[model samples]
Target: MTHAHFAPGRRTFLASMGAAAALLPFAGAGRAEGTSTTRRYVGLYFNGAWDVLLGPDPRDPAQSYDGIDLGTDALAAAYRDPIPVMMAGQEVLWGPTMASLAPHADVLTLFRGVNMNTVAHPAGRAYVNTFIPPSGVVPKGDSMGTRMAAAGAYGDLILPNVSIGMPTFNLVFPPDVTGVRLDRATEMTDLLEPLGDMPLSEATLAALRMAQDEVEGCVHEQYGRPPVEDLQIARDRMRQLLSNGYGESFDLAADADLKARYGITNPGASNDPAVIAATVWRLLETGLSRTITAQLQTGLDTHGPEWATQQPQRQQAGFDALAALLTDLRQDDPNLDDTTVVVFSEFARTPKINGRGGRDHHFAGSVLVFGGGLRRGVCGATLEQTLGLAAIDVATGQPDPAGRVLLPEDIGATLAHAAGLSHDPFRTDPLLDWIA
Candidate 1:
């Protein structure tokens, strides 16, 4: 489905990257009614096509395959090897890089054979995030983060949706729900902190508020337009932000234990995997945002000899950071009890090793959805030899001839359903069996 462009008359203020983290205030008449879920969402995007053989859809190195490269023949590395792990009585092979995450096998669920439908980087990323097959290179729908905000899941949160080094699109969702972009997690402090100390005294502050209210009254009397209303909303929200002392809560570096756990030596200058994950945790723990999408790893598009080395190292580092995030969440505040983390790559690498000793892009993908009330198990699979997608029963997550191939829309719909969105614009239903 396509969303109409933002009307010329509507005034929507988006947060500028590298600038102050300003937010569009909730200008609508409060939030839409009937939001049924309190669960928050975290999206960890592994940019570039990840090699599934080294991640969520690993294959045994000792196995003989007709067309698949187990990476054991010529391209051999400790990280490229797969290790068997049992989850819910099922034996699954996870890349050795998943060692840190394997311990949490009981709380996470794996989805394989996800048909990304596109091998292009931009199109695949857009499709996965927006749940609409891109119209060429453009996204046709709002991101799940924006949709969750529009669904009123964030209530009156000032910064409801946050995108950190991840693409977030908004088509029809309210402008207030647009994801605020940030390069580093510590920038949140910059967004919330006042430019300088409150130079105005209480009397002056009250006077300024009165003057703005008077001007707003005059503007409303002369021009009853949406833009004027939106401006007033922004003003009121900024005032609320300054008065609430929200910036103080986002001082992540001040937390000695958090710094030690995430290895955040300098939060302001660091955008490492640990820092990004820590920022996500802080945002949710402080109730500053409901939905967050962050880029967890990069450089996975290995079509050269480095695939045997760099690919696994990158994947392992990313997984290690994620495992730490989960542990921190569960240990400190039980964030995992009420929060769901969705990890995805645009697509998986080709099954066979190329002439360069690397893998090319493959449309069949895998996903990891865990935390909240999700059951721990594996769903869907790839063909034994070719590594192509296998049709799976959506309910049972098992391969079946009569079942349909899982699409990005199904994942999107499931996220929306879990978030308690009343609408279902996706073409398919959610995987109900995966939910608790």
Candidate 2:
């Protein structure tokens, strides 16, 4: 409903723009040559910490049942239903909630050793989006979405980055390059048709433009460049919005079967996970956006006694929505061959169940990456004793006794690299195995 987060304070937004201009090379860098691919990205954020034990784990018998001790009998019962999936000739176990994604095992790769570094929700989410470890203060860096949009591939796009039902502070890029957030898919049409039935004649439109231009000239001369620049950017955005045929992407009335497949039974509530996934796929399919970030309506923060009962439902909803999205991409989306999907949570739930029968936040998390020629099979390892992430060799994406823990920065850098963006500015090393 409220889109206030999309509209940052004018002063703050302008200051970010100025700062971006000062670091032109880093912030505005183009994609590397010889890496010019039409690859697009979709970032799916599962808000609230997810429990990794609910999914696949490293095959260490000693560590295989780490979380069971803290769970109730009901929670322990859930583990007995894990589905075995064969990936790259090796069998991997997927929890019952993830059974929907089992059919696509060869295309999906799960990572087990991601360290978010913080247990706090806001900081964890920020770290995943901005790829910069938060120091209690908001990081000045832009999100991977913003950076990918700023790259040359989507430079001329009307709305290169779109955030749907997601709280984002993607401020690293220039003001014009920042992402636009929509509450729902139909909002795309609302934005494009704000005038409704109040159509103006050509003469009236021309007169209004002339008046606006004259006033803009006077403001430029009287005030300063910042205000004028901001006004111009706003005007340009409006023009681009009107010229781009983005509304077509939201025209789902004729595709009843498609809607059903995506679980969009009610068109009014687009916040449904199925609808959210459908909206993002439509945006990508229609070339309306080069990068999309969407938040699922299902919550993963099961911090109460009902966690065992609630978690499976939430995870199943997420997995089903994602599986449906992938189905459509593989069967319908024209950009399927050039797209990559990354699904992750801010953090993971603790291995030990808390007093309330629910899990608290943990420092480690897991991620699922599919499409874009990525290799199948799991990367990184979880420790057998603590159920924590083990150190990994970035180059080999394997466990090494002397390696360091894999952090959110490494995952972010890997995503940037997969999207063909330059990762020289990021301090984290990319997981080379993620790239095909």
TM-score of each: 0.84, 0.83
Q: Tens digits of per-residue lDDT for model 2 on 1-436?
A: 1111243332233233222232223444556666544567778878887777676452323334645443535664654466778977888777777888877787877778788888888888777777778767455467666776665465455556777766555444555556677666566667676464788888987797677555533333433433445454455556666767766667666578768888777765665787777777787777667778788645778988767876767777878889988887776444344667888888888777788778888887888888754666777777766777798776666788898888777766776776667666578667776677
Clash statistics: count for each candidate: 1, 1
The Cα error of candidate 2 at residue 257, in Å, is 2.1
Could you report the Cα RMSD, in angstroms, for every candidate shown?
A: 4.9, 4.9
The segments of candidate 2 whose C-alpha lies over 4 angstroms from its true place after superposition are: 1-29, 56-67, 70-72, 75-80, 170-172, 184-186, 195-197, 213-240, 243-248, 251-254, 332-337
- lDDT of candidate 2 at residue 204, scale 0 to 100: 89
Top candidate when judged by lDDT against the true structure: 1
lDDT of 1: 0.72
